[model samples]
Target: MPRIVDRDLEALRETALRMGSLAEAIVAKSLRALATADPLLCKEVQEDDLEIDRLDVAIDAAVLELLATKAPVATDLRFVLATKSVATDLERVGDLARNIAKSAARLAAAPRIELPGKLDQLAGECTRLLRRALDCYADGDPERARRVLDQDDLIDASESRVIRDAIAEIAAHPELSSQEIDLILIAKNLERVADHATNIAEDVILIAEARNLKHREKLERAGDRRT
Candidate 1:
């Protein structure tokens, strides 16, 4: 027989996972819309965001309820706290996807220009990172979450390359400056999505290991590490 608090915690986990899955799908759809230049798909991404927002509210309520009524401590407390942060990150990821979709729609109206640099590759990597981060959360695998953290730097570099390439393109073809600007914005939104994914991965590590690795690099440099 499970306690009520245990059941509630499991329910909260399920809700978080559901929200994460929806967010991941929204990101993929937004990227597809950008690649195919489909305004209809852009609208769909916007519509999906409402659901993400709702889930975020629900998760917040649940977290508050658990804290006020359940008195969760130790690992349970960490899980609840981390889930709240994860929900916030996922909600922002949804917003970033919507922003990308809007930029895609705008680009669709303008004359087609070759996307500068490895924009497509960057989009793919960001989406993959998001999916993997969610998977680590679901599995409660701190080791795998740490790996996801390591991949953020790669996505950051890719975004920087895209921006540089788009700047060069704008300089070369001043007439297409508007479209180039949109491309830069889309690249930035994708980079933000990757950032949210990394944050979620960090939360997963916190939940599983009871260790705060968000500032792991600085701690390592200063040799102030504690296990």
Candidate 2:
């Protein structure tokens, strides 16, 4: 049964990684399509979302099977739950990319709006955070996961700046108000995508150590006070 268990575990890992990679590619390619307004790339993202949905279905089945057969406990149990949770966030992120792609499709014929400076930087930050989060998951490294969660605020701030600028642009140019609004929504969707990636990182940290790293600083402070 040891060999069987090992094979099951490997299968679980492979499925999760495949799903995560698809989600990551969606974010990366969607951002590029957004930045460049390349119709071909946007169409690629549209097709990629279908692949993500397919993987989600496949991974979900693998997870349920593992639980039924492996009956993992303690850290392994936590890993199973965390895998489910991360897959959920990744699925949502995939949807967000698809939404952006759909929106881009609508604007394909409309004039290309250059992604604002803050939005561009936010996309760059998200790409890095997502890459690191996936690395942490594969290696079971809590420290790298925590770092991704810590850097989330920077992306959030950039998101806020874009919102403000978008509002200003719409107010200043009433004629392009509709166009400005669509771009604004796209930027917000990307910001939320980053947030979901951070959630995955946090989930990884919690699973790898069988401890909640959430509010970690507060927990440390409380320990100090008790001591």
The parts of candidate 2 lying over 4 Å away from their true place are 1-4, 213-227
TM-score (all chains, Cα) for each model: 0.93, 0.87
Error of 2 at 175 (Å): 1.3
Candidate 2, 1-227: lDDT as tens digits: 22135566667767778888999888888777766678898889988888888877887887887777667887777887788877887888898988887667666667766667787787788777778888888888998888888887788888888889989998898776777777778878878887787878888877877766555667787884321
Best by lDDT: 1
What RMSD value applies to candidate 1? 2.3
Q: Residue 203 deviation, candidate 2, in Å?
A: 1.4
Best-performing candidate as measured by TM-score? 1
Least lDDT summed over 10 consecutive residues: which range in candidate 2? 1-10
